[model samples]
Target: MKRLLFALTIILALNVALAANVDLDQLDIAKFSLTTDEEKTINFEETEYIITTDSITPSEIKLFFSPNNLVITAKKEKPIEIDLNNDREVDFSLTYLTNLDAVTTIELKKTDLPEDEMDDESSPISDLNPKDQVNDILASIKANLKFLVYAVIVLIVLIIIVKSYKKRANPERLYSKAEALHKEAQEFHKDGDEETAQELYDKAEELREKARDMENSEV
Candidate 1:
């Protein structure tokens, strides 16, 4: 299970990395979001926007989305710096007429920047399309949730008490048989030997069924 989790983590990391690529010429994005005219009028703090564009020229970027449609300069970069880099400073802004509230997505493109102005840390947060990033995070959250389910299964297994010994009335007998079957069934299932494991499971279940019948008959 640990190995599986490690593999999943690696895959998630790789996908995120690939999604954040800033190849502007080809124009792709990790995710996107939008802002309403209501939001456009207000200044937002820590609020995100999704933007979409078919093409981006150095002088101006043409947009064809909903809520707002306008051309904005692409020559300058839009910088919305946050605390993600531990810099504790706001150091980015885009000098374009394109309001995030009016745009559906931000098309990523390749660009050259001087060393002093380049910040790679914000690349992942800014470039990823909003929806895709949300999906990735949700998937990671789901993977983590599996551990909780495993923990609960363990708790229930641990709480199992076996304190009777009257042959057909013994709880220990039933639990022991069950544990043995569970282990074998899992191994067999992993090995893709479902038919044999199912047969064994059926036999173990038959024992349990007989015990249940015995208890019911006595009652």
Candidate 2:
């Protein structure tokens, strides 16, 4: 009994060691790139970053932003979008650190928007009232309804064509299906249902014959 207990203890120790040695590099970490032509320059007011990892909790990851000065520890994996600076152009760096010693850093420069371009009146539809905007949206939807109907009809036709082509192309599928039915029929026979089992067997045989004919035609 003592020998058996020692062996079990050794096995448990080995399991614990293996579980603790999980490599972060082997995990599926997503790569991200900025929308700007120059990564060092942040042309947009708001920047977005998507954090992703395989089987790792978001709480294990930490984010640190410098110059703009922001720190966040995520409770869940989601896109991080924030305004770096609203006054003028500024350069900042974002650093991501994981509990598993994985690190990622991104540097960006923000650009200031022109005063005229930043005005809310610059929007084309900003002058329209709420009722007029609703009417315009309804009119646009009504105008597109006929095109939407045509697109749906085309999609349905394509689906039917693809299904028919697959049925013609895959004669082996029928044989595999027939084999499954035969196995089920044998189970039904074992259960003492002779009538149902016979029907199933007959159907299986019919499918098998069809498959054979299709194979011969291909030859």
Candidate 3:
């Protein structure tokens, strides 16, 4: 009985040791995949794809990982925003919204992934500083101010041009009214109607006054 009990105890200890010391020296390839058949496809725009749950019956995503050592976390539009790609690893907040039915997707991803995408070692772009990697963005007000100023200048120039054209196209302008009145007065004088010509001359003088008034208003 003692010998049998000793053998069983040795077997259990070896089993525990084997589970504890997994061979991690070799490269373990792991993947995270999602497939949708409910007519919602993922198009991430830049060779990558987005997984949407629109018009689907169940609206669920599947994840597959390898090595069984990775960790998974999920949230529906977490309260705090994340700035990814600074490091190869992801940092998720514990305060994420637990509800999965939000409009924006709930990203459940594996943070502990292999640093080397391939089995072979690669370049040192991954060692860059987070600030150096990040790009500076302009303020919204500054951008809108540029567009607004351009629009206002264009509007003012158009108004000035339109007002100038209206001034030149008046009924009492040089060519349209004064010249016509002069011709009419000359015709009346040539017809030997002196009294009519005097009245027409007065009318022409009134038209001249109107022209002067229009010019003064413009200046």
Clashes of each: 19, 1, 2
- Each candidate's lDDT (Cα)? 0.45, 0.47, 0.39
Evaluate model 2: give its TM-score.
0.27
For model 3, how does the per-residue alpha-carbon lDDT over 111-200 read when each residue is reduced to its tens digit?
233444322223222433565333111222232344456555655665676678677757567435766767788898999987887777
Please write out the lDDT profile of model 2 over residues 1-219, one tens digit for every residue: 235445655665544332221111221111222221212222222343232222223253344434455445443333343445545434322323233333233222112334443233224245557975676556544534454565556556656766777676577888888899999999999999999999999999999898888778778
Rank the models by TM-score, top first: 2, 3, 1
Candidate 1 lDDT over 22-128, as tens digits, reads 22222212233223321211112233232345454444554332233423334434533222123455423333333343443332312243443244534644555
List candidate 2 stretches off by more than 4 Å.
Answer: 1-164, 167-169
Q: Which has the higher lDDT value, candidate number 2 or candidate number 3?
A: 2
RMSD list, candidates in order: 17.8, 20.7, 27.1
Q: Roughly what TM-score does model 1 have, to 2 decimal places?
A: 0.24
Q: Could you say which candidate leads in TM-score?
A: 2
Clashing pairs in model 3? 44-49, 44-50
Please report how far candidate 2 places residue 66 from its true position, in Å. Answer: 76
lDDT, candidate 3, residue 93?
21
**Which number leads on lDDT?**
2
